[model samples]
Target: MYIRKKKNTSGSISIQIIKKIKGKSKVIESIGCSKDPDKIERLLKKAHKRIKELEPTLFDSVKQEEQKLKFLPISNEQVIPIGDELFFGAIFDRIFNKKTIFQSVYKANDKHELFKALVISRILYPGSKLYLSDYLFYFKKKEISDEAIYRLVDSLYKDEVKQRIEEAVYKDTLAKVGGKIAVCFYDVTTLFFESESEDDLRRIGFSKEGKLARPQIQLGLFTTLQGYPLSYEVYHGKKYEGHTLLEALLNFQKKFKLKNKPIVVADRGMLNDANIAFLENNGYKYILGAKIKMLPSGIKDKIINLTFIDDNVTHEINIHKTITYKQDKQKHSLDISQRLILTYSSQRAKKDKYLREKALDKLKAKIEYSTNLTKNDLKLSHYAKYLDIVDDCKVEFRLNHNKVLQDSKLDGLKGYLTNDTTLSHKDIIEHYQNLWHIEKAFRISKTDLQIRPIHHRLEHRIKAHILISFVAYAIYKEFEIKTREIKKEYQISYKILRDLIKHVFAIKFDDGEIFPIKLSEVQQKFYDALHS
Candidate 1:
C-alpha cells in the first residue's frame, strides 16, 4: 500500500523494512529510511519471509573531508602575533614590548659590553651556558666563540653599567613622573670575597652583615623610597658604614642637583657628629638613628629619670618621654638633648632575640673553624674573639656543638638622633620603619636578583653591575605599581596576569596553516583586551 499526505517539506520521513517468519513475528531485520520514500517501498518488496535485508539511510554525513581538503580564509583579526614586551625572563608580556625596551636600554647605554651584560642576565642564567650561541648574531654568518662572551663579561664593570642605567632611569622617569618628591634613601651592605689579594679596591673590611675575617667590599646604595636608584659607590674594603654616610650624602648632592635640600634618612650606621654637622652646614635635613652608646653619662641619667604617659585612647598608642644629652670629648662640650621616648613590647624583644641568635650562630660557626687563615684575621676581634668559646672542642663536630648553642640578644634600647626634634616620637619611629622597605629591596636584589660577590675584578664594572641592578629594581617597582593600579573591577593581578600569559602558546605550522596551538580562555581574553 502507498500513502501520500502533505509531503513534509520541513521534516523528514523514515520507513522500516523487516522480514518475519509465518505467524511468528520477530524483528529479524529493520531498515530505516530518512531519504526517499519511493526507494524505501521498493526495498521493502525485496524482503522475503525466510531471508531478511536491512538497509539504513540518512540525509548525509558531515562534510568533514571537504573541510580537511579546503582552506579557510584567515581574516586579519584572526591572526595574533606575539608582541615583544617580555620581562622578568619573558614571563610577562607587558604593555611595552621587551624588544623595544631592550633596544631603548641599549641606545641609552650605547656600549656593546653593557648590552652584553643585560643579555647575560637573560641567557647565562646560573647554570651551563648551553644556548649561548643561539643568541649570537653573525656579521657574516660566522659563529661567535665562547671566548668572546668571557671577554665581554670579564671586561664589563659596575660603574659604566651603573652610569648608563642611572641616566636611563633619570631620563625615563623624569619624562614620566618629572620632579616628584622622589625621596632618595641611603643604605650600605658588605660583600665578602674568597680571594685574598689586598688590591686597592678589595681589602679586608668590616662586613655590614658582620662577615668578620672575610675580605669584603663595602657598597653604599642611594635609592628613592620608590626603589628608583639615584647613585651607588663602592668604598674601601674596610671603610666604616659611618664613614660612607658623608660621602654618600655628598655624592647624592653632587650627582643629583637637589634645588630643595632632600630630607635624607639613614639608620644607626650614619649617626655621627661630622654627619650631623654636614647636614646642618649644607642646609640639609636628616632623620638619623641615635646610638645609645654615643650618649653621655649625664644623658643616661636623664633618660632614666624620664616619665611615661598613656595615649591608648586617641591613637591607641603608648607614650614615653625622657631627656638625654651627648658629650663630645673632642669638642669638650655637652650637647644637651631632650625627648628620649622609650616604648616596650615583648614581641619586639622576642624578634630581636630570634635574629640575634641566628646571626650569632652563623658567626660563631665561621670563627670556630679557622683553616687557611688570611692576613685579615687580626682585625676581626669582634667575632674572632668568640672562637675561644669553642676552645675545648675537638676537630670533630666543632661547627655544630661548640658554636651553635652560644646565645646572644640584640640591643633592646635603640635611640634616634635627629636634628628635627619637632617630630613626634611616633612619627620618628614610623619614618625609620620605612627603612625596612629599602632593606627589603636590597634583600630582594641580593637573593632574587643575585647581586653579590663582584664577579668582575674591574672597579668600574662592579659599579656598572650595581647600576644595572638599580634599573632592574626601578622596572620591578614599576611593574608592582602598574599591577596594583589596575582597577579592582578588572580583577587582574600580576600573578594572575602572569598565569594567563603563560597559557598563551606559539603555533608553528609546516604547511603554513594558522590555528591555535593552545590558549586558555582567560589568556585569549587578555590577548583580545590588549589588541582592543
Candidate 2:
C-alpha cells in the first residue's frame, strides 16, 4: 500500500491509500481531502499512520494480540465499558468552545464545565436535573454533582447571562448573514408544565398543545430569515399573543441597537390593528398575514371579485384607514396606509375545500344522529356559522346555504398585509412564507430539545433551563448548516445524526488510553463534515 495525493477539479487534494495489482491502482482507503496546506500536511501524516495500522506485519500483529490479551481479558468483569467521549462529546466541545459566546460569558472553570455538560446533555439526552449527574458519569465519565448543576443554574439567571448570550447570538448571526438583517420572523408558542399548581411565572392559560388545564409559559422567539434564533423572551402564560409583538420587538431593537430596521413577518395570530399601527408608528416595516375574512366589506368584496389568470398571480389593493386603540385607559388613534396582496394556489384551495367538506359532513352527522339539539351543541362547533336554528317549543336546524356559498367564493385565496411598497407582491408573500422557519425552530426546541414539561418549580431555574435549550439549539443549527454545506451529496437528518452520535463510542484501556472504534462509511462522512 502507498499514500497518494490526488488533485481534484476544485483545486483540493485528496489523500488516499492505494494499492497496485496488475498495473491498476485500487484505492484501499481515503484518509481525507482538504485545500489548506496545513490540513493537507496533517492528512498526509494521518495517511502514513493509517497505512502502518492497516498493513501490520506478522510480528506486529502477534505483539498487538498479546498486548490486548494482557490488558483486556475475555471476561465480562474485566471488560471496560466504552464511553462516547470521542465523537459526541468532542464535536460538542469543538462547536461550543469555538463557535459560541458562552466561553466569554462563563469564565470560571467549574461553571464552564458544568454549563457545557448541561447543554450537551440537554441536546443528547434530555432529562431532569437529578439524572444529569448519572448521565454524565455513564456516557462521558465526567462527574458533576446535582448541587453544582443547580448552583450554575442559579448563577445563570443572574448577572445578565441570558442577555449576554442573546447579544452574542445576535452578533454571531449578524456576522453570518452578511452583517445585515433585512427581514426577520417572529412567533410565539406555549411551553406547559407537568404540575397542576400555578406560580407567578407559570399560570394556567391557553395551551398551544391543548393542555388548557395545565399551567404553561409563553415563549416568543425572533429568528433570522433562515431560522437562526436571535432573541427570545418568556412571558406570562395568560398574556395575549398579539400583545407580545410590540414588547418583544422593542426590547430586541433596544438591546441590539440595530442601525437598520428589519421587516417583521408573522402569522395571522399576530394580526391586530394595534400591532399594525405600532409597526408603522415605530419606523419599522412589516409584512403581516392579513385576516381576509375580517377585512372591510368593500375591501373584501374587491378581493373576492378579483380574477386570477394563473395560480402564481396576485392582486394588490391599497388601503387607507385610521386605527384607534386604548393605552393606559386612554384612547389613541393612528392613520396608516398599507398594501394588501392576495394570492391564489390550487393546492391550498384543494386542502381548504377538503377541510370544509369534512367539517360539514361531521356537523351534518351530529345533527342527524341527535334527537334533540341544544344551544350548547351549536356553540361548540366551529361550523356553527353555517347552521341556523328555529325555536318554537322545539328546535329545528337548517344549513345556511348563503354563508356556505360566501365561504366557498373565498376559497383558494390568501392575503398578506405589508407597508413596504418597494417590494413586489410576490416578495411580500415569500417573506411571509419564511415565517415557517421560526415555527420549525419552535418544533426543534420542543421535540428534539424537550423544552416543555419543565421540571423546575423556581422561576429562575425555569429561565435558566430555557437558556440552556436556546444555546443547545444554536449549536444544533450550526451543526445542521455545516452538515449541509460540507456534505452536499449525502444529507443527514438530525434524528439519524443524533442516533449515530449516541452509538459512536470509544473504548478506554486500563492504562488510561482511549481509542475510538472503526466507523462506518456514513459515520465517517458525518464526522468529516463536522470537523470540516
Candidate 3:
C-alpha cells in the first residue's frame, strides 16, 4: 500500500494510503515516507529500513492470525468530528463576561467606565450586588475582592465621571437638536425607601405614587426637545415637587453659566401666580399649567368658551394676548404671554381607567376586610373608615353595588404646559412624552446600578453612589443608541446586548492548554457601535 499526505490550515495533515499494492518494497516505501515532517527525517529512514526486512509473503502467513483489520465499524459520526472553529471564530469572546467589563472600568481607563459597569450590571442582573470576586472567578477565573470593586464604583462619582457624563449628554443632545425651543419639561420624582426613618435627606414626604410615607430622595429631572437629561437636582426626600422647579432651574443656570433668557414649561404644581410673575419679570418666558379651580370666574368662563382644535393645538398666549380679559388685567401687567400648547391623548384615558380600577379594587378589598372584622382586630381602621360610611351610610354588601369608578373619565388625560409655541403641537407633545426615558433611566439606576438606601452613610459616599448611577445611566443610554444603529433590523435593547456579553466558550487543546474566546462579530459590532 502507498500513502499520500498533505498539510492544511489547521496545522494538521490528511493522509491517504494505497494498501492494496504488492511486494515488500511498496510497503517499505509507504512506511518510509509516511513519517511526519515535524520529526527527524533519519528516524523515518531507519524505521522504513527495518520494515523492509519483513516480506509480503510473511504478511500472507500472518494474515489469518491478523484478525482481518476490524476497522472499528467505521461510522460517519466518528469519522468527521465537530471542531470549535465551526461556530467560534475567536478566543477572546469566549472569555468576555461582566467581570471583564468591570475590571476594565475598575482599572480606571476612562471616567465613563464607572457608568459602563453600573449599566452593564443593571441590565444583566437588576437589584443585585455585583461582587468583584464572583465577577472575577466566574467571569475571568481570577481573584478580585469586594472592597476593590466598591472603591472603583465609588470613584465614579469623584471628579470627572459625573461631570463628564453631564457634559457629554448636554453637548451631544444640544448639537443634535439645535433650533429655537422653549420651556423645557421639568418634574420631580421620589425614589422611595423601605424604611420610614433614615436621615433628614431620607425623610418621608408627599409620595407621588402614594408610597407609604417611606423615606425617599426627590429627583428633580429636566429635559427638553429630545428628552435627554439636561440637569437634575437630588433634593431632600421631604421637599415638595411644586416648589422645586424654579430652584432647580436657578441651580442649572448657575452650573452651566447661562445668561440667555429661556422660557420654562412646567406642570400645575408650579402654578402660583407669584412664581409665574417672578419668571416673567426676570426676562424668562414661561408657560405653566393653570388650575381651572384657581383661576378667576372670568378666565374660567373664557376657557370654557374657547374652541379647542380636534387635533393637537398650539396658541401664542402672553399677558398681551390676555389683555381683553378682565381677569388677566387684574392678575398681572408685567407678564408676557408665551405659547400654550394643549394635547390630549385617548391612550392616557385608558391608562387612567386602568389605574383607577386597580386602585379602587385594592381600596375596596381593604374596606370590605375591615368591615367584616371587629374594630379591635382591624389594624387598618383609619383607611377603612374613610372608605365606608360616605354620607353616613351603614355598611351593606350587595352583588351589584353602585361602585363609583372615581375620576374615571379623566383617568388617562394628561396635560402639558409648554412655553415654546414655535414647534408644532405634535412636536411639543412628543417631546414632553419622551419624559418616560427618565423613568427608564431611573429603573436602571435603582434596579441595575443598585443605588438605593445605599451602603455608605457618609454624604460623600452617597453623592458618589448617585454619581455612579448617573454615569451608568449615561452609558446605558449610549448603548441603547448604538445597539439600535447597528441592529437596524430590530431593536437591540440593553438586555440583549448584555446577554451577548455574558456568553462564553471554552477551548481545550491536547497539550493541556485551555482559554476562552473573545466576543463574536455581533458582539464586537455592538460594542464598536457604542464607541462610534
Writing each residue's lDDT as its tens digit, candidate 1 over 465-521 gives 565566555555554444443425467754455444433433334456545545555
Cα lDDT tens digits, model 2, 1-532, are 9999999999999999999989999999999899999999999999999988889888998989976776555333333333234444564455344434345544566676677778777777776775567667766557766677778898877746666666766776887789999999999999999899998899998889999899999999999998888888889899989999989998989899989999999898999888887788789999988888778779888988899877989899999999998767888999888999999988888888898899999988888888877767668677777887786343466888988888887888999988897998778988999888888898989888888789889998998898888887877776666677544565666667666766665556666666566777777776777666
Clashing pairs in 2: none
Candidate 3 per-residue C-alpha lDDT over 322-351 given as tens digits, one digit per residue, 9 for 90 to 100: 322123346544434554444445666577
Worst 10 residues of 2 by lDDT: 74-83
Best prediction by TM-score: 2
RMSD of each: 14.2, 8.9, 14.8
**lDDT (CA) per prediction:** 0.52, 0.80, 0.52
Better of 2 and 3 by TM-score: 2
Query: Residue 512 lDDT in model 2?
Result: 64
Name the regions of candidate 1 deviating beyond 4 angstroms.
1-84, 88-164, 171-178, 209-213, 309-342, 349-413, 484-532
Instruction: Report the CA-based lDDT of candidate 3 relative to the real structure.
Output: 0.52
Clash numbers, per candidate: 21, 0, 23
- C-alpha displacement of 5 in model 3, angstroms? 32
Candidate with best lDDT: 2
- Candidate 3 TM-score, C-alpha based: 0.56
